[model samples]
Target: MDGRASFRRIAAVLGVSEQTVAHRYRKLRESGAVRVVGRLDPCYLGHAEEWVLRLRCAPSATLAVAKALAQRSDTYRIQLASGGTEISCHMQTSDQRARDTLLLDKLPATRQVTSIEAHQVLRLFRGGPDGWHTPIASLSPEQVTELTPPPPDPVPLDLDDGDRLLLGELAHDGRTHHAALAASTGWHESTVRRRITHLRASGALYFGVDFDEHLLGYSSHTLLWISVNPAALDAAGAALARSPQIAHAAATTGPTNLMATALCSSADALYEFITTQIGSMPGIQTVQTAPVLRIVKRAALL
Candidate 1:
């Protein structure tokens, strides 16, 4: 879904009045049931590297450690997993210096952290700008086509000060009005609009929806760390990306090269997915399942 899409356009696709669509969206946002957030793909940034970190902490210190990590701008989707002894999160670093400062200096200095595993993300098969499709479908194929945005052009982009300010606001609320964005960037409304167009076209900016998954009957969430033969990594990853159970799948540099998040209706469903869908795949050597005990922070900064 395009978070920046106009209410009128959405209403037309859903066969609802524009005012009704706007009202429902406002209520949802105000109730904290849904949010639209702007996100940047670190892969598209020339100097940035993405990594997934798993930290094993003393059981008593897990929440505190996870909360402290959530306060850092580089970390997102922080979760307490493996029965509250492990912390998992995705992090982005602008350069080697930043990476070392965290992985080498800051994290290792923490006494409660018993172990750390940092896996550099090689390729993202799902999630990021591609987004995840829920197993439960709500729209027809035609409606989905009407709502989908055009593919971004992967062109080089240099962010100006004004563009950064504009992005800072959008990072919190992707659907922020153009006038509000202009105020944040100190640019004219027309200029803000044009800059956004350029940013999205260059693949420097994209939007994502944040909502309560449990409200939609998706109660089981777990992270899968699967070790696969190097020769079959690509095939196994592509297959996982196609699975309806997977919310995000990525290839990373580690003993367990394939990592994915599975969202299902129940623990039984997750077990079925692993034993049937994942177990049936070839070249799978070892599988580790970590149930997410709690979400400390979501993908958005706010």
Candidate 2:
């Protein structure tokens, strides 16, 4: 149901009435525990590079720095790491020059941060909110097959301005009604439907389900930085991608070639995963874990 936004289709898959699916979706939405938001494909927006930034700031400047970073258009995810003096953020940008300005020019000038390390993501084994295989709700294979959306297609580097409005609405609510979209885009309901279909087909848009893992009984989340032999990078990334506890993983440049985040039920669970499963995985050279103290921003929304 997380990926399947259509109530009618969900009803068909679950063998429930359409009305029942609609009622349940409404309840879940109103509960403030779950949200389905549309995320723009960075490639479609001309962003070909992604970077993870780790910043160590003075104690008094931690919150101030986080607030500033969270306000940037390129920043997709921002968090305060456990020590309360460190901040971690993920961003995507189109131009290397712009990235340099943020990393080399503007950030250093801020004077609040004591140190900054930027890691360039190389390949995404599993990244983003929807890339992982962990299931908050279980559905049969047949049901999932029926609910799966079509594969993405390539789109132009520059998206149309009108489509941006549609994307904005979808960002807030992936299942925004056609009539509402029409009102926002100044188009007919039919046009809104056609445009959305085209956007999805062109890979300009994607939907992700957002929820608090703590609310789902997973109380701990840890971000991991792992170093691996150059030849074993893919192997390490693929292994983490297969773990049910891993929420996000990617190959990147810098001291650590891979970065991953996992959700666990408790500190002991996180330790077990790191020591037993990950420790046993071949090709892994070193692993460093950082607990997330708070998430300041997620996706494109705060």
Judging by lDDT against the true structure, name the best candidate.
Answer: 1
lDDT of 2 by residue, 115-181 (tens): 9999988787776534655564668787777777768677674567888898888887887889989
In model 2, where do residues sit more than 4 Å from their true spots?
1-4, 15-31, 43-46, 95-98, 153-158
Candidate 2 is scored at a TM of 0.88
Residue 137 Cα positional deviation in candidate 1, in Å, after optimal superposition: 2.8
* Number of backbone collisions per candidate: 0, 0
Residue-level error in angstroms, candidate 1, position 287 = 0.9
Off by over 4 Å in 1: none
Judged by whole-model lDDT over C-alpha atoms, candidate 2 comes out at 0.82
